[model samples]
Target chain A: MFASRPVVHPMEVAAAPANPAQQQQPQGVLMKDLPGMPGTPSGLALRVTQFLLAAVSLAVMSSTSDFASVTAFCYLIAAAILQCVWSLSVAIVDIYALLVKRCLRNRRLVAFFAIGDLIACGVIFSGACAAAGITVLIAQDLLMCSENHCSSFQTAVSMAFMCSFSLAPSFVLNFWSTAFAYRVVAAG
Target chain B: MFASRPVVHPMEVAAAPANPAQQQQPQGVLMKDLPGMPGTPSGLALRVTQFLLAAVSLAVMSSTSDFASVTAFCYLIAAAILQCVWSLSVAIVDIYALLVKRCLRNRRLVAFFAIGDLIACGVIFSGACAAAGITVLIAQDLLMCSENHCSSFQTAVSMAFMCSFSLAPSFVLNFWSTAFAYRVVAAG
Candidate 1:
């Protein structure tokens, strides 16, 4: 298990690569080399799913009458729109990378994806919770919603929740890839 | 910038250590070796702050009359309680590490901390948004809350937000360190 290789200087190990961000082309150094990560087929699929769910949520909320009157619903609408735009943009990137057969393993790009996904995750989660909370209050406690309005509000909230769920895996995968990239920089 | 190191075996590098979990005591490495990471003094301070803020939020929410009647407020209470318990436990661990001058740079432990912090961040954020939304509705849209209840709810939401803010740095630091650890294992 201890096959020796030619000696390399510690300073060499410490030195940064000329283009570190674009340098990782792991031949056989480790496990599958960032498999199923962002910029891959799986990532493209995730992004597409996110975009569709967010769009559906946004459409549902937009169709609801006077949804703008409730602050929570308004926030949900805004978040859904943000999610839709962000996911669609990333999906387009993923498609281009797939068409060109280029790996999206650049540390910088993955870091950007990770941070962006995190922000989206937080914002969407907050929106869904807020909308759901208000819907609950309106339907159960306040008794303020007509049957039709109440159903529309509930549908929009549920759609928002579905959007959040679809975004979760993307968030986790991006985070892991980014974390691994940072680790590679330090260890190398 | 290319320095060489003594020859080491590819197999040995690939081989897992007998106690990999306890073996990371980086010395003479770049970037100060996980400075301000979890289990350090800075980490301890973060945990303490999170605990105090969560506890205060919980206390305020508990003191409010009819808070349980609102699902959103109940969620906030639950999240705050969870935050307090989680943060306090981690703080105790941090204290032990500090007193003994032991670094908590174990990759596994740090990974655990990162995941836990992420969960707590999401939960707290959602709870804060939900509570804030309902509070706004009650006070402004519905005009159902008495002056005293409205003020108390507002205070609790603000504290919960503060708790989330304090947790953010801790989450980021732990994530970075854990990412580095994973990289080391892969790139060795």
Candidate 2:
């Protein structure tokens, strides 16, 4: 059942060589080792994606107030969806490295990192939910204004629910990552 | 002039045990001899603080639409003050240890956590500025409405700034923790 599993160290899986000398060299001559920077390519990509998402979110907020502006709303939704995808990708990669690769050899490091990942995932998830909720609330507000039959309290409740729901995903991610990290670290 | 400095390998410093048992009772002890749970004190305290802060933020958001009423708005000032205290304490205790004691003792972990701290500080600073701007905008709106000169652009700007600012601190905190945890895993 586990015939294809790789016996990789957790640290090795997480640590990508950042020093140019340690990178793939031309035609097999041993390159001199140098101090490497931290963070993997995936991590770097995620950071860039996060920054882009933040920028798009800011731009959307600045450009529109009416939720009915489909273009602006779509932009916001796109940025959020992108964030979710990035987060899930990271989570999946981490899990894969831990499981199939048996890469979680260093228990301490894994535990710490897992906790951190969980928290980040939770926050991002929550933010997404909140964004969606806000959109719905705005739509409801517009509808209420036109109809003059809806209670403000209902809108407030919806907003609260939305914000809380959005926060939940990130929190769950954080918890899961932390638990996994702890197990790895303790095992090591 | 440099009498106080002790020469030690960075790896040794980075991997130093948090528990005295790991250091002092190694011959008689197994890995489990050390406390099963690490950083329990700090972890518990942090969780409590986070809960309280979250509660305050929720209350503030629920009470008023005025940005000033948001607990996170106040936290900008609080975080600035806390940053000073934390930074000074870190310096006094050995910056490396302070940064990575509870997380893990690795250069990558320390660096990541430091970055996280910096991000959190930056978010708080920016949020405070945005909140101040919001207060000003609110005042302007009140004056304009009384004089029948209110503009939607001003409202849009205020909302944009507030939303942007609101997201920063938590976002930074999330990423910071995640990155730090990942480093811990890598280094472990």
Candidate 3:
């Protein structure tokens, strides 16, 4: 489809006019647009989901360290760890924001979230695709799925994708808000 | 830092108020934000870069077809091909846009661009990381660097990253514009 008319969907709900925060709330809006804003329940939940997914992915893949048998496995570890740490830190920020009732939404903060989430999304996507590729090898060409830690590899790959998917909404949300902040600038 | 003030950067140049596209330009802005906005020098350049990079990545990786030894290699093919097709069609669109001077920007189109660019970026990232992981394995653990297609593998991985990098600016530009367009939605 070349050009479809605009429709108000779930994603656009954040930009709805009745959102009073929009008035004196650029910062708050940015914070709320975050997947894991500390003050917002929805955002925190998204962050938790990402953390849990990354952790699960790591646990499943690491269930058998045979990942070291391939560099992709090592990358899975790196991606999972990065997701974990990122989710954890954001979660902490959420808590801190909640405690202070402070808004974390601002152009710079949204930009930070956008960049961080995007990079992690990239890593997770790469890990998942690579692991999936290798998993296919173990199952088909290698015919080692039955004997080796193939199941673990599969599980890990699945979780890596799950982690990526989980992080996606936040990425989208942060970027959407950031775009708004970005458009308001006047250049020389 | 949770709350940093915004800093005007190069990316914001396109969105500056002085740009004629700002007024009666929401649709045009959306159109211009596209990577393949026909006739436009910058837009065409971005599309060409993406196409060339993807093609090069595929050519280098497919040189030996030893990649078939690993599923990750297969995935790389898939990613490369998708990129190739996507870029080609968009390139055609750029040509069309140039000829017609027609507006292709709209919420749905921008949304499509956001989702498509984001997904492709994810796939490219995944492909590169996976291949790189395997490349490391071949060079170090397998001690096959001197004998096998190590150089080829390295070249492919580099090209894949190069493709990814080339795609980044367009992706960022599209999202930035999408966010701007997105902000105009009616509030609740």
Candidate 4:
């Protein structure tokens, strides 16, 4: 009885054309077509913005003579540097993809982007929160916010927050795109 | 000329049995069969461990007489509380799945787990880092580490770190499983 039916490999099944519904709609579009997705113009813009914000954050914090004296501020500097490097590299990739008009929706590439963004999110979040914690202490007069470059520190921390905020959508979209690409090959 | 071939649906193509290579391999297994994956015994064990660690972290931190005195410590407390609640709830779900011998590989469930885990990771990581920053300052004698349950606070921070570490594998597994389950539905 089974032999009467055509043998269908699962891999081929992923691209099968029998279902009219499947044929009518595009497949594997979990927000991949969004403007901010990787390889798109908006993606490049977002990456550039992230890079600029992180760079400005690091630069602003470093300008303060006494930032190094606090462990939280130092951590923020490290996080900002990481964010800057990551965003710049990805922006370069985005620009290249745009120039060539190539799709950056490959599973491996999406996975890489997702993981990198996740790490960046965690690191920057911690740095920003820690800096904010210390800033609160300073504000409460527990320490000397007035004797040092407190305003600059605050500005740098806010920049980090902005950079992280921009990263949030990218992170979710890439993760969703990756999930949509999961057409696993069948086993014998 | 185009009508010569059979019309196949993409959904069926995902499960097609024609490809010998695909038939020889298991489909949709991005580490989903591992013990630590959801709906498995090891997954339950990991969740229990996470819950215990987070609970202990919160308990220890709150035990200190002056933890509320510092904003960083207060943040740590909040993070620990969030972790405890999240892990405990998931552990209950894991247990129920195990009791019924049911698979928890549904797309929505996996997505929920992934997002929750990501948020927990960020929160706890920031909390731990902030607490550690304060600890460093105290150790350097910039603050009074010798007074008001300093050692207890340190222990609590360590517990939070451990809880986050335990969550790392679960986070990766759930994300992978969610990706593997991403078979887009055919449109009507």
Candidates in order: C-alpha RMSD to true structure:
6.6, 15.5, 9.3, 6.1
The C-alpha stretches of model 2 lying farther than 4 A from their native spots are A1-76, A87-188, B1-188
Tens digits of per-residue lDDT, candidate 1, B1-188, equal: 42252333444555655345435645212223454576678788889899999999999999987887888899999999999999999999989988998777777787799889989988988899889999888787778775548888999999999999998888878777766665566555
Quote fnat for model 2. Answer: 0.00
Fnat of the models, one by one? 0.72, 0.00, 0.45, 0.42
lDDT for B70 (candidate 3): 84
For every prediction, compared with the true complex, DockQ reads 0.44, 0.03, 0.28, 0.34
Residue-pair clashes per prediction, in order, are 7, 22, 13, 31
Question: Candidate 2: global Cα-lDDT?
Answer: 0.38
Greater TM-score among 1 and 3 belongs to: 1
lDDT of 2 by residue, A1-188 (tens): 12233322334423543444433433112211111101233433444444454444444443444433323234334444544454455556555653554333243443454454444433433343333333333344234345331233233223322432433333334333443445344434
**Residue B133, model 3, lDDT:** 67
True lDDT of residue A188, candidate 2: 40
A67: Cα error in model 1, Å: 0.9
lDDT of 4 by residue, B1-188 (tens): 13343444434555555665645544442234656877888998998898888888889888888777788898898998899889888888888988998888775787799889988987887788778777766765377766657688779889988998899889877776676555432210
State each model's TM-score restricted to chain B. 0.81, 0.32, 0.78, 0.79
Docking class of 3: acceptable
* Candidate 1 clashes between residue pairs 3 or more apart in a chain or in different chains: A3-B9, A8-B4, A8-B5, A9-B3, A9-B4, A9-B5, A12-B3
lDDT value, candidate 1, whole model? 0.78
Residue B70 in model 2: lDDT:
36
Superposed by TM-score, candidate 2 places the C-alpha of residue B131 at a distance from the truth, in angstroms, of: 11
Task: Give every candidate's TM-score on chain A.
Answer: 0.80, 0.34, 0.79, 0.80
All models: lDDT?
0.78, 0.38, 0.72, 0.78
List TM-score per model, in order: 0.81, 0.28, 0.77, 0.78
